[model samples]
Target: MNEKNTLLPRQLGDTHIRLLRIYKVVIESGGFAASEIELNISRPAISAAISELESLLKMKLCHRGRSGFAITDQGEKVYQSTLQLLGNLENFRSEMNAINTDLVGELNIGITDNLVTNEQQRLTRSLSTLKLRAPEVVINIRMISPNAIEAAVLDGQLHFGVVPELRSLSGLTYSSLYQERSQLYCSEEHPLFDKNNEAISDSTLCEYDAVIPNYPQPIKIKHQQKKLKSTATSTDREGLAFLILTGRFLGFLPVHFAQQWVAQNRLCSIDSHNRYFDTHFFTITRKGARENLILEAYLEELEKTL
Candidate 1:
């Protein structure tokens, strides 16, 4: 028997490889026209590739007519095998390149909207450095909640994420960036302004209708534990600020974000002498994925700034 034919299914030639790849594209895209858009190849080229593939195998691979395209029975079998074969080849390439160069590929990152605003500049600086150092690589940034970020990374939709230190999930690794402190705040003209801690107890604080922003509402882990009563919730910071300014309610704000308000005496921290609440910010990635140089280097860059 010829060596090529004797070699098992594991061994294949370049022609076979190309055919399998094109077949997969055709099947995934549902037809030649869609494949042209996805593969950025001409329609004639896709049709030609498919024709050659069927000729070599002596099999009719697809059903085509005026309506659309559908894969034949034999085509389905070939498609499954092709997926495995192409995946193995790609992994082999990744391993070989790992020995010689920086990780090169696209990375999608999910982050909370709060982190987007608070850390946008620092992140932009890091991304700028990555673009300069590795011009061939691409990165996509998205804003999502902590829970959604975890789910996306787990589902392979996102390579990594930045989120608050929340409940733990399996197969995830987190690195602490820094600790953020928070404090109860109200406009300087509020009734509790300059009042002692006793005067600002739960009962007294609950007397007035409290307004707190719903999203990006300034994470206060301790405040969440205490569970003070609130009459209304607002999603926009402006709404929360407006209510506080009007002396309708007392709310909590991050000491850092609320700095200017405190400086101008527009908002007063309930207890200047006591440290009140805090949360540790963190960056998370799939545990097994840090071996990727792109992810490793990106983490390194973020660490330098954070």
Candidate 2:
């Protein structure tokens, strides 16, 4: 029989996981001696751990010699598997801790960029209130793309996510949060900087270079987005705002987020009442996932504030 077939199947115990974790650090640290401070163990212990792990898996995981440390192909695959296993284990632990009435556990929230400046403050207040109610709860927020947020929530990597009300995804539930009003803007150096609604026509505004959001949008927003016919596109609201501030391009930005520049005369809206659109935002959570009391409490707080 080949060497691979000689190994018997076995369940991993705490010792096995510990050895795997040590092996992970060794791989990441690039050498056994390099991992000593991080692992808080001697070089000999780290070496022994890697050897034990290789024995359990019945493979030569790495090579260590005067030529320096190098992970074998099998070791690289095992390291990736170790990362996934540990992540799942932590998620399970956090979820279990959150199921009790005490609301003590971790809450991972993924949010689209630029929501921090929203005037409605629905999410901010909900998070603050959730913390007050559950002092022991650990709250983590990830600022990322709407698509990424939805995907994370679906996979149980994120407990909840806040994103624009674009097309809803399967296996997720959405709750209305607030609407963000966006309007076309030009900076002080633009030709239309001093123009008002009466001075700029729809055709006149379209003649300039423009930037538009690159993410997916609902039909209503898409129609408005098509009007500008942008030469540039950004995946996030912050990037859109940056392009708008350049004075070389006209773009849309959330009214609240643009106020900082508007108040300084650095930006002016172009026929805003006629060129604006409202994007509805929502909080989404995965359906049929294990119950999490911390998420529940936050949702309750959100409902109360909304």
Best by lDDT: 2
lDDT of 1 at 121: 47
Q: Residue pairs in steric clash, candidate 1?
A: none
Question: Which runs in model 2 stand beyond 4 Å of their true positions?
Answer: 1-91, 98-100
Best by TM-score: 2
Clashes of each: 0, 0
Alpha-carbon lDDT of model 2: 0.83
> Which tens-of-lDDT digit does each residue in 174-285 have in candidate 1?
8776666667777877887765253345666667667655544244454552455677776544566667777667776666666667778788877544525676777787
Per residue, candidate 2 scores C-alpha lDDT tens digits across 124-203 of 88888888999999889888777767866875668899989888788899988889999888899899895646446668
lDDT (0 to 1) per candidate: 0.68, 0.83
